[model samples]
Target chain A: MKLATPRRLILPGLAVAVIAGLLSLLAYPFPDALEDSLESHRPETKAAEEAGPRPSSEGSEGWSAPLPDYSVPGVKSEGLGGALAGILGATGTFLALLLLLHVLKGRGRRGPNG
Target chain B: MHIPDGILAPHVWVPLAATGAGAVAVSARAARKRLAEESVPLVGLMGAFVFALQMVNFPIAAGVSDHVVGAGLLAVTFGPGIAVLCMAAVVTIQALVFGDGGIAALGANVVNMAVLSTLTAWAVHQALRPAFPNLAVAVSTVLGVLVGAGGAAAWVMLSQPYGAKFLGAMMVTHLVSGLVEAAVTLAVVKALRASGLVPGDARVVAR
Candidate 1:
């Protein structure tokens, strides 16, 4: 079990990050399986639908995401915004994971002198 | 399946999220024992690939769509512990940065998206490998999707009384999409193996 340095992992990880960012632009513009499943369960009663999250409802309004639906704020163009968001998301995820693994890897390695 | 914030009751999401967090913790601890300098880049790059592939959503029937979950690839290539850790990072990023899953329901998203998906795929692959070596990846991947989707459906069903009826719908749709998952995972695994990135059907080095 040999470990590759962070430097060696960077290229491959960044390649994936870039590819994901690019491919994300082509993601289907429709509800995914889970979203579709939830939609199929549309409230039988109008009241139920109204009770749950709506455009101006509890769930939708409760949390405000910086990049809602993966679109950059004030970015009018869907493709550009989504592409930017995808790149950012992919890169961000890679970097975040790298940081996390670094911390995990560093645990208990402290020398007695340090 | 990324569960949004408002749909699930707090009781359901709370426990699911707690379980997700706990599993990540436990998996992290386990992963630490196996974490090696050589394996770090493999896991890191694979995680990036998974996060990237996840964005490509292909259409499926009944207004549903499918994408590469990649848990099978991770579980088979690296083992379940690292797979789960990678998944946690991917899903959490989707939630916080992309708004794919609701923040409130992050727990459910993590569990269905990665925890169950990775674990089930690994379990199925481990069980079938000795017998259906060729088809094991496909079988494991499809079952993984089933588990991920089924677990999500089950959670929603428990939280909502009307949810039970829709379970069949989710399962059926996922079955259709599962084919795509299998194909994609198989392709990626073969590609990884060919590139010498992943050892050939080797037992998890960590395991």
Candidate 2:
């Protein structure tokens, strides 16, 4: 099982990252299946509806999301914000995984290929 | 599905959080020992791919959409241990940075998507791959979603007695979404193998 050299893998990886980031801009705005299923189970009483939104749990109230719902803060255009967030998120995840794997590398017995 | 905060009771969330953290620790050890030097970049890129793919939710029904969970994809490409670590990273980022899943319920979400989903998918793949390579990838992915969703439903039921009634509905919805997951996983895996990024003998490489 010959491994694809890092050089060979880079182009495809970048293509996927970019394509996925761009495609994320077209993400449907509808609630996901879990959200919809959970919503259906909630009581639809008049008073409950009138109560507005329920409060978030304790210890998490003070926290603020830098890019809430994958939107950039103060970004006027939804499409632009989402796109930027998507790119940023993909980059961040890629970097984070690299750092983690690096730190974990050589901790135990080396793999056969290694 | 990412479980939001406040839904899970303290008792439920606390123990689960500990378990999630412990599982991640063990998986990290396994990954350190088993992961290959040349595979690091591929693993990171795949993690990014999964994270990005998750952002694109496809609407499946009235008021309902779903995204690629990608645990099965990672499981087939790398292995269960590394897949779990990658997914844990993705889920943690979603909760802390994106606020997609609740901070409090992070443990539950991780356990469902990262641990249970990846392991179940890996198990299914290993069990069926020899006899049905293509079929294994698709079926394992669908089953992964089903198991993950079932775990979520179970957590809800344990935390709140009334939540039990929604299990059937949750499974039904996830079954539809699972097919979508299966299709995406199958397509992506086939492409990876064709490109030689993932070898024909993926299992041998993964180990």
Error at A68, model 2, angstroms: 1.2
Clashing pairs in 1: A2-B38, A3-B37, A3-B38, A4-B37, A4-B38
List model 2 lDDT by residue over A1-114, tens digit each.
777677987787777667566888787779887777667765355654453223265536877668888888999998888888888888888899989999888545465444
Backbone clash total for model 1 is 5
For candidate 2, give the lDDT.
Answer: 0.83
Compute the lDDT for candidate 1.
0.76
lDDT for position A49 in model 2: 47
- B150 in model 2: Cα distance from truth in Å? 0.7
| TM-score between candidate 1 and the true structure | 0.89
For candidate 2, the TM-score of chain A alone relative to the native chain A? 0.73
lDDT of 1 by residue, A1-114 (tens): 333456656667667766666777877778877777677676577667666532122344555778888789999998888888877777777678777877776772564222
